[model samples]
Target: MSNLNKLDFTTLEVSGRNYLKWVQDVKLYFTAKSLKATIEELIDNEPANEAKKATAMIFIQRHIYDAPQTEYLPEEDPRTFWLALADHFNHQKDIHLLEARHDWQRLCFQDFKSLNEYNSEVCRI
Candidate 1:
């Protein structure tokens, strides 16, 4: 269906702030399209597999920001591009974890005027 072909989510940005969510979205999309194999493994010389790989690569490149597009322009295989993106952005998780720990450490019981506000902050952090 035409609706199924339309992209309905945000693209991955250069900042890597949305890397985790982006990866999840990409996986789900690829799975729905039956193209997950293009990123999950090396493709053989079969024409169908080659077409799927091209589709997957185009989808990924179209969903990424300009900086990453230029940087990964030379990459031809979707699997390699996927792994390169993971290698580049996986550190975002550690950075986010450290920031969350810092916020949790700085949280004070008496800082909020209401119990609900304090609880909300705790959930957010």
Candidate 2:
């Protein structure tokens, strides 16, 4: 196993609703550092569902920030927390796609005063 002292979990902080990507990145980081066994140990030590949930929350506490002064609650199962974030962000992504489509549909060459400006606007869209 690699030296755990040199690893910084803080660098894996989960910001916004990018939980899926964040989780993948964290897992890869852990694997790269040969700390995958450490994660298994954490899960193994918590036998009961409640214990596992609490353990998960605590394990990820410093690595996640849902809001200002608000972190994942003890009642939240880490799996549930990640799933909820994934679902929420997926919905937001759909909304963003729709907005982009609307904006693209409304874009017009006449809105720009010059050929170069119109080309830039089209490229932006």
Candidate 3:
């Protein structure tokens, strides 16, 4: 196995808009290091809950932003904290989908400088 201390895992801050991508990145990071079980045990506070909680809290804090960081207390169950984020982001995803659909419906080629620009705009949306 690889040395956990030396690995430079990707730092992904959950900014409400990128939760899905963030979660996937984190999972891949841990799995690559064979540390998924270790992380779960730490989050669960198995043998050294307090110390583990402190370590887990720091890790969680580093990967989250603003409201979510404050909303889910570090003292609470880490699973619960993760679940809350998932729920919040899932709802936001639906709203974003609706907005994207609306934006696509209203998009027009006339709004761009040229056909190339128009194609780029379409790709962006």
TM-score of each: 0.84, 0.44, 0.61
- The residue-level lDDT of candidate 1 at 36 comes to 86
- Model 1: per-residue lDDT, tens digit, 79-110? 89999999999999999999999999999989
TM-score of 3: 0.61
TM-score of candidate 2 on Cα atoms, chains taken together: 0.44
Which lDDT tens digits does candidate 3 get at residues 16-84? 666666777766765674435434545555443455445554665666665677776653655556666
| lDDT of the candidates, in the order given | 0.89, 0.55, 0.63
Clashing residue pairs in candidate 1, if any?
none
The residue-level lDDT of candidate 1 at 31 comes to 89
Candidate 2 vs 3: which has more lDDT? 3
The lDDT of model 2 is 0.55
Scored by lDDT, model 1 comes in at 0.89
Name model 1 segments beyond 4 Å from true.
1-6, 42-48
| Off by more than 4 A, model 3 | 1-15, 35-57, 74-76
**Predicted candidate 3, C-alpha RMSD:** 6.2
